[model samples]
Target: MKQDANEFSSFAETIASLGSLTKLESAMSAAIKSSRVPAKETRKMLKCMSIQEAGNTALFQFMRDLFEKVGVGQLVLIRNDIFRYDFAIDNSPVCKLYPHVKGKKTCYITAESLSQFFTKDLGLPGTAEEIACQNAGDNRCEFAVSLQPLAVYQLALDQLDKTIIGSVIDGAGPDKISESLEMSRDEIIFRMNILKRYKILDDDYQITEIGETYHKYGEGMGGDEEEFQPPWKDMAVISNAISASTSFAEAFTEAASQEPLWDVEEKDIVNLAEQAKKSKSFAELLSKQVKSDMEE
Candidate 1:
């Protein structure tokens, strides 16, 4: 819709005013407010899946489904692997906002959202970089999310998982480890298989160097697992942004609408709110109404 475009355009203008690096950083950070909700919900479909099972497959599928659900655009997966995942968005909404700006990567929101989906949603830690951009003369917006093995394993492993690894590191067999942990041998074997899938254990179940490193530091260097807090708690925004009806644009609009919080008033925020409500200005809203009636 034009309203969303204008609000995003305002945000773009403000961020574009800063130094190149700061502008990119702010643009990426701004995506969290709009992106976190759908990413959180879409992840539930794969809740029972572990990083070992979901890493390259379910994780990517989750992202593909999420971008569509959030009305961002279709995510075309190019490659899937343990270290890197490459994807492209042919219709990147963020890129289309900058019709006149050129010669630079402009899909920072799409890129960062992918990073958040991996780390914050799928428990896979990584940073995503926009490698090719339509704005920079590329045919499509392309991104590569690179994962660090240690950080991925750290977040992927649970307390019992660490215990299993530590037991393996001490040369204990599954039967002995299972007895020690007061768990069924099948469960112990299952977890060990998960560790093996992570390349922390060899074919014979002996611990690898990755396993040794993980045993020492995977759980807070062998202490605790940290969790990501939602935007309301972290950003000091309204608590009810969790409502199912709240879309990404709505969230961004609300955040922008809080103009008084800033050092200076942002007239763009007011314009966005007014533009969003009027049928003549917000084609997206009109389409939503039609879809809602059809669904009803």
Candidate 2:
């Protein structure tokens, strides 16, 4: 009886020790389900990576936009990998909530939020870990995400985006890559900038050791990528609705002229109706700035 009692006592103590962590896990899950942070936002971030060619600064801005939309503030990208990402938040709110709590990682909610956001919302098979926390005397709260290889490839790369790598494999220069891929010289430059940002290609536009491995294994592996529904379906629905109504397109085109293309104002949603019209011609409008999200 004493032995059984001791075992039960140990189990109870274990649960108690993990009580806050479990509660945090539950809160993160509930927030994710309720917020339903659109997958399109994530897709937009990846798309921005390809098109903006503005490097980490642009990436950080997109993340800021995304996390702010979902009520997670001040997210900054630290280290980005093809199948992994590292992020940090400054002066974390959850940590601030626990002034007396110190000496250990206390930002379980933010860490779990990132994990659930990637796994549940983005459909990326991954988990995020809190590597550093201000409560633990770190300057910022850092979270690292490790995603499965093929799943990330499916989500991150467009079919044509791989052409640059293919060109590199064949000893093709930027000009050759551009000609083979039917992309403009400017577009090729943008793509090269993105490749360099990944360290996949070096200064001479040659594929690095990592790029060679990425080519050997990561390429042509996501056969089931099409099974996943794109987040742009909602926009497609609106497009279909407009296409269904014959008058909508003409009316939209007239208003779209007044609408800004890539530089749409964020604070003003008053002209969202006009923006929807622009979304119909999203490719043409973003043509100068971006090509497309993912061209199948």
Candidate 3:
């Protein structure tokens, strides 16, 4: 959307008023001069700018220019407060606000924000992906943004697969999958049928070799087997090196060690194991290995 120059200037002035233009500019320059810019600080400035009373079109254009100048043009800002800019660009909503209930004063976007944004702006064809945010109290509520369409789809598929498998393994009907994945019975059936067609899910909803591999490694069994290999082997090597060290007590210590083989602590080893368990493939692991070896 186009906006007048006068309106843009007004919005800019409001942004400067919220936070000292001098301070923001200094931070921006400092960040730019450094090897890497601090995105969070930059975003904080933008957030202040966005919340100022201004026309959506003018603010949107201003933000567009600001991010573009900083070499982060593709990144979209999602505002939770309505007083802030609430608009969409490139099939993505920029701002969303949730109603604050008693004792929940923190202003943040809800999971429904993603669902509505994706469904309305992006015009996603299929079912909406379920997303939830974890609060400090360990309570989960709808609040998250999908990194990408494929990522959202993969997450939904994984959830569906897990629910179906868990239910079947427990000798329950597929209804549990529908409930857990927040999909309708029809959707659950359709997804299961598709998996069956690909030989991933069986008649009883049991995970086949293909499904099991995908669950563990995050790649379709029909595709290249290389894609499904987990990075645990490389992580194991790192863990072993860390475990063998006497001076090092953590991965960071081992990584910083001058010795050829660095030592890692039991906790760090377990953390790496967990990461490997969640890794999609060995590519990330291999890349990390190469970097680690180079450092050594």
**TM-score of each candidate?**
0.50, 0.53, 0.21
- Residues 120-224, model 3: lDDT tens digits: 422222232223222222233323334343332342344445557556546655687677667798977876775564456788667778666666666342222
Between candidates 2 and 3, name the one with more favorable lDDT.
2
The best candidate by lDDT is: 1
What is the Cα-based TM-score of model 3? 0.21
The segments of candidate 1 whose C-alpha lies over 4 angstroms from its true place after superposition are 1-71, 76-83, 98-105, 115-126, 132-140, 178-186, 217-296
lDDT of each: 0.58, 0.57, 0.36
Q: Candidate 1: global Cα-lDDT?
A: 0.58
Per-residue alpha-carbon lDDT of candidate 2 for residues 1-296, written as tens digits (9 for 90 to 100): 33322221232222232332333334334444433334434544554452223234432454355454434457877766666778888877666544444576766567767877778766777888899999889998999989886576556665565778887888998788888778898999887776776667889888989788878877766554324443333334423332344343344444545554446443222232223223313233335224333542
- Candidate structures ordered by lDDT, highest first: 1, 2, 3
User: Residue 123 of model 1: what lDDT?
Assistant: 57
Q: Per-residue lDDT for 115-206 in model 1, tens only?
A: 87667645567799999998888998899989876655544566677778878878899999989999999988877876786778898999
Comparison by TM-score, 2 against 3, better one: 2
On TM-score, who's better, 1 or 3?
1
